[model samples]
Target: MTSQAADRPEQVASRRSKLTREREQEFFDAVLDQIRECGYDAVTMDGVAASTRCSKSTLYRQWKTKPQFVAAALRSNRCPRFAGIDTGSLAEDLREAARAAGGTSDKDQGLLQALGHAVMQDRELQQALREALVDPEINALRDILRRGVERGEVPADHPALEYIPAQMYGVLRARPVIEGEYADSDYLVRFVEAAVLPVLGLT
Candidate 1:
């Protein structure tokens, strides 16, 4: 056979490698879905392998442990929906931001709820989840609020401007469990008026 004909096998192998990578991603997503459905404590690498039709060793090779695998999965799924918070007014910007952040995402919120105990027990998991899911969004929201100060919509010295994102997110994350109500648009607006807007002197 010609050398060009021999290269056909190489091309086929490369295409197979691409499919392998895609299947690996599918396995990871399936594991995350099982965790969300059954809770983290209920999931096992062996179980994931059985469900995904892969070897348990494959999962271990890809991610050292369940925590490591879950952390990577959480990182992979993080989305930056709050990157466009410009509504031309601080109150409106904040309202929009709250809308973007109000509801828990299906994967994220479920993973967070399930992994809370696991994370508390594992320092690596705690750090990984915080860096992956929490820190980037928090920092970006801070920057959005800082721009509001620059635009003079909020006073440079406004305490609320500095703390609003944290308060809003903290409440949004906690209030459902603590108060049994979702952080809907109306509730978020009320929070802004009673807690945030007054501090910024807008109310």
Candidate 2:
């Protein structure tokens, strides 16, 4: 029954893949919702499992801990908005990216707050967060800058073009902690107009 044995492995693999995908989605939704409703210190794998109708054992088996699980959650939520920005100018691009970065999502914000202390202690989780959320978004913006260079909208030698994404992300991430303020559109717009565009000589 070699054929039967091979078929069984394939079937099991497929089933496991499906289960993993479903559970991961459930876990991410549960984590974000729980973090939004409760503070970072208050969220737990047990709580997430109960909310998502999954076993705590399953979550532990997959992620090992809440920090690892949250790291995975952050990675899953990354979306690039590069294609939406087009004002036919470098100023428009920076402004567009900053504005987009500033609009804070409640669930995502809560997730970040919840992961704060955990991220400090967990290197793997921090790397995962960078890989999942930060890197892709930054890479997309970098691509935008590269395009601007090709179009001659921004010079290849411009410092602002090279550093705009960092400025955008740094402020977007740190503004809340720095000023105890939400990362709103107004702050991002001001940053773009005041600091970012000025560096680019766009204003």
Candidate with best TM-score = 1
Quote the lDDT for 57 in model 1.
77
Task: State the TM-score for model 1.
Answer: 0.80
Clash statistics: count for each candidate: 0, 0
For model 2, residues 148-195, the per-residue Cα lDDT tens digits are 788877689985676777877787668768887767777778888988
lDDT of predicted model 2: 0.74
Q: What is the TM-score of each candidate against the true structure?
A: 0.80, 0.79
How close is each model in CA RMSD to the real structure?
5.1, 4.1
Candidate 1 local lDDT, 15-50, one digit each (tens) = 542336678678768877987788888989999889
Model 2 pairs in collision:
none
Residue 195, model 1: lDDT of 83
